[model samples]
Target chain A: MIKEFIRKRSIHVCLVCTGGCNGCDIEVAALLSQRYDLEQYGIYYHNNPRESDALLVTGTVAKQWQEKLVEFYNKVPEPKAVVAIGACALSGGIFQQESDKVGAPVSDVIPVDAEVPGCPPRPAEIAIAVLKYVPPTLASYRRKI
Target chain B: MSSVIWYLYEFARKTWIDRFLNAKTDPEIAEAPSRFRDFPEVQKDLCISCGACVFSCPSQGAIKLVRDEERENIFPVINKSSCIRCGFCVEVCPTEPKTLKTGENYLIMEEYRILPQEKVYIADEYLCIRCKKCLEACKIGAINFKDNVISIDQSKCVSCGDCINACPVKGAIKETYIINIDEQKEIINTLIKSLEGTINLEVERIRKLPDHDPDKIIKLEYPLADYLQKARNIIPNDEMIIKTVEKVTDRLKMNIITWDDEKCNQCRLCVNECPTGAIKYDEKIGKVERDPEKCLRCTICYQTCPFGVPGLYVARFLLKNNVILITLKPSQIPIRG
Candidate 1:
């Protein structure tokens, strides 16, 4: 009953930046502002991966971030879902030219459930992606458990 | 004490308290700005199937051409997953009023004002005869020799029709209009029907003649001379209309000329008169030889031969239950050369 109550009332998300321009981070941050105020939807933005229910991943996975991303993804709880944001996260944007040195897509390092693919997606799109995709993934995870 | 009372009264107001209690933003997603270009919308009927949208799209597999559900019309379909809403497809659209649109200020810049053109010029390789007349006629050097074949550079060519005018052979350089495709088909149908009608009228008279032989040699006037003006109203290009008429005449096999080897008197009249040298007298066999490959079917030999060595026949087409039936008969009177 307590688990169901926690699932229905609140979801905690962790923002992880692999290696890209911080354009998508600003849009994700706008969700907390008065214009969007995503907290009203019973969602909280927290950096701690241990307690978070979802991971909002931004930027292309740099060479150094590849091993660190696996460690970060493993730290998150079992019911966690990953949402890749921006063109950099889905496919290495302009950074793909130096592919050997830096650019690698987030999906290459860790599994992704949903993707919001703009240069830097609008704040509403990020909110929609979190709301629409994360719940079902958590539900499916509970069913498997 | 008055200032304290005013502050207390302002805090106690129900309207001011209600404003803070309500949600700060609208529950729905905010409306994007007028100039914000999202995914482009396609207007299918206006699309010319020129593949301009497909060519301009930077994202591979974002846009591609596909036939409609009815399989009659072909248009572009956008794949939303791969599309970045870049608006390149909307900008490069060549049709007037655009076949692809995104927003009010979708054009973005004035320098990219794409001029809409109704006519497009193309080169016909089969009828080109390897002549480089178009290359010289093009002032902008739009026509060039590519891989041993002359091809037109579409970007450089301005559709001035100078290359078409310079071409010696008919149907070598073609000017194709993009609009009114259905009307063009209807006009071609009308022209074919009118040509069949004119030849059918003459065929009926020949059937009643006392000396009428189905294989007799005769002549008739140009069949499409009367209906050329009527067709010009719908299709303004006279040369294009004439080319269509010629192509249809050939496809239907409406005109035929037969050479009778036995009827040749060896007078060498046709050999001298033949402009194309299709006929020649052989000294070894003491007989005249006619080459069908070299024959232009110009009917010069038909007029030159007094013994009716060459026979000219007109064919009429009858479409019955989806099957075309062609009937060939000789002209009733000899056409004056």
Candidate 2:
């Protein structure tokens, strides 16, 4: 009940970067600006995974980050949702050709609730995806509990 | 004390509030530009199944040809996941409404539109004599001879069929019809049947005659021009129809010229009259010798020979079960004495 009440008041999103061209990171960062104003909807960009309710993952998971990504996902508290941003996070993007350097998509390492597909998805699209998917995922977790 | 008062005054003014209130937000991100190329939309009916889109696509497995179970027509299907939305498929689509469209307005330009060709003219490199006659005959200069090869430019060609007419070799420059194949096959069948029917009666008459020589040659009583005219009525293009008839006649070996060595009086008349120099008197052989390889079978020697040395005969053909059976028969016209 306390978790639901906290989520109802405000949602905290943690931005995770495994490995990519950093183009999707720039677009995600755009959401913080007043133009997109992601915080207007009571969403806060928290650096800590434990405090965050949702995790927005960008870039293909490189070999080095493969183990660290699972550790990061485990750190997030229960009733947490993961949203994959950009083609790289979804399917390894153009780095798919270099199979040796980059691991498979983020979904293979951790469960993904929603996906926003584009070379570098628009900030509005990422904002919409996070808003639409995170609440339902949290609600389903509450029912399980 | 004055600096402190100035700081208080600057804080009270709040000059940054206007910029924050009028923030630039791009609410129109969903509304893409007119030329923004998204995934291609396939129009199955407009596709001619030429595979041009498939050939032109840069991304592998982005577009593939699929057969329709109900209509039995082949059309292209776009794979959304693999497609990069390059718009190459839309640009190369030859249909009017276009088989594939990316919703781009610039594709409607006159220069980008490549219409589906009804018939494409191509030169058979092996058969082409490289005489350059077609190059000269083409008014638009669509035909080119480069590096010992003759090629036709499809973009510049008007399909006027002037090059086919100017070609000395029958099959050198050919017309390949990409559309209405079944209709063309029907017309060609009718023409072949009519031609076969006309020559069938004479073949039966020769078979019934007792002690009749199969080698005997006679003139055809009826000219084939009327039957050719009937074929021309169906296919308005004279060159294509003529080429079709010529191909059929060539397969049947319509004319056979037989020369009698004894009848030649050594007058050397046929040798003088022969256009291709196929007939020549060899002093070693002590008689006139005709080279079969050089002979065009034009029947010039048959016409010029006074003593009836060279004989001309027509052949009747029956195509049964995919096999063509040819029979030689003498014509009904009286032999010149």
Candidate 3:
């Protein structure tokens, strides 16, 4: 019961940046900054996937990094959430044509929970995406009754 | 008679000169009548060499790239008869500046041309270190390293998850979605609920505040401040509540107090904290009450309430493990004194 109580109070998120340009990464990091203040919603970032309830992945899948991508996904605990942010993650975008190396599309690689598309999505959008994964309330049904 | 003879001689001389020059040309060209033919001209400077046009061309032997003697890149040369006028090469070029133009007898044909599929890089299984570096590389979050094996979750995946490109191992991760349906739904639903709760809280708080008046305390801001003061009395050491109050007040651009209700132990924190002496205990009702207008929603009374209920309508309260998540719904429920 105590474990459940602790879980309801805080949301842990893991952020990962893949092989695309750093545009999406900057936007996502802004959420944790004072301007966006994601912690107000009880959302906190975690370095370890084991402690994370949600995972935010940014960037396109490059030919060289495919293996690391899979390992990260497996490390996240069950009932975890994953969000894909950007056009590169959605489609190969410009890189799809430029490189001779064949890079995998995001959906073709892991189980994405949600997709937010843009060359680089705004910071507000990233915060909104993170907020979506937290539970609505911590009070129980019996308490209401 | 002399002028007429001169003119005749001059005309015959010119005709003889033309016949002599024509006799040197090929026999086929000499026998056939000349006709205008339309042909495509490629802009070598604009081509980025993406190969979209080259790969898209349908005519087997129609177009070939020959090195430009004066330029660094290759240029396309067309054998007129070999070109079926299909125009596939013009449609698929990625560089718009390098388009093929046909002049005069040639009409410009614009059509959608599909390029041939390029092979996607799939990770080979043997080299995987399970580091998940590629997973972080992907913005789409499609890489799933499950059970020491890397695979894709096809349904939620877009195939652009290309974390495989960053993998240290050659084929540890492949391009494919491997996760099942139930798991995906759980992730999606949780995300939705979390987002809704946060948005609703923000909206509700803003709506309760007086519309952008700039000067006076908005209805929502004042009441929330009061509620925080009340909560602080009950949980004196609760840093979370204090931080929340500070954060909210700053966001709303108002002065506020952080109430700690954890230490109250049933002792009325409000009776002491109220500035206007508005709080009064109702032993019969087993709860305290205050005059609505006189109370100021200052939340001084919340600190003494013993229970963590704020001075507002409770929308939903969920208890999971030991944590409490509360959703407060704004309402005009009167606080009877």
**Each prediction's Cα lDDT score?**
0.72, 0.72, 0.53
lDDT of 3 by residue, B102-204 (tens): 4332333332323322223355556677787877887776567777876544434555645756777644664422333343344333433443344445543
The digit string of per-residue lDDT tens for model 2 on A107-141 reads 88999999887667667778888877888888788
Candidate order by TM-score, decreasing, is 1, 2, 3
Give me the runs in candidate 2 sitting further than 4 Å from their true place: A5-9, A98-100, A143-145, B1-30, B33-35, B49-68, B71-83, B103-337
Model 1: per-residue Cα lDDT over B156-230, one tens digit each: 767788999999987777777666777678777786666556555665454443333656533444435556778
Model 1, runs deviating above 4 Å: A91-109, A143-145, B1-24, B27-29, B67-72, B106-337
Residue-pair clashes per prediction, in order, are: 0, 0, 95
Q: What are the clashing pairs of model 2?
A: none
Better of 2 and 3 by DockQ: 2
What tens digits encode model 2's per-residue C-alpha lDDT throughout B187-285?
A: 678765665555545654543433236565333333446655676667676656655555565565455566667778888878865645678899886
Tens-digit lDDT string for candidate 1 (A1-145): 5775677558899999988899889999988998888888878999899989899998778878888989999999887899999877776664544335554567778899999987678898888888888887877765552
Q: Where does model 2 sit among the CAPRI classes?
A: incorrect
lDDT sort, best first? 1, 2, 3
Q: What's the CA RMSD for each of the models?
A: 23.6, 25.3, 34.6
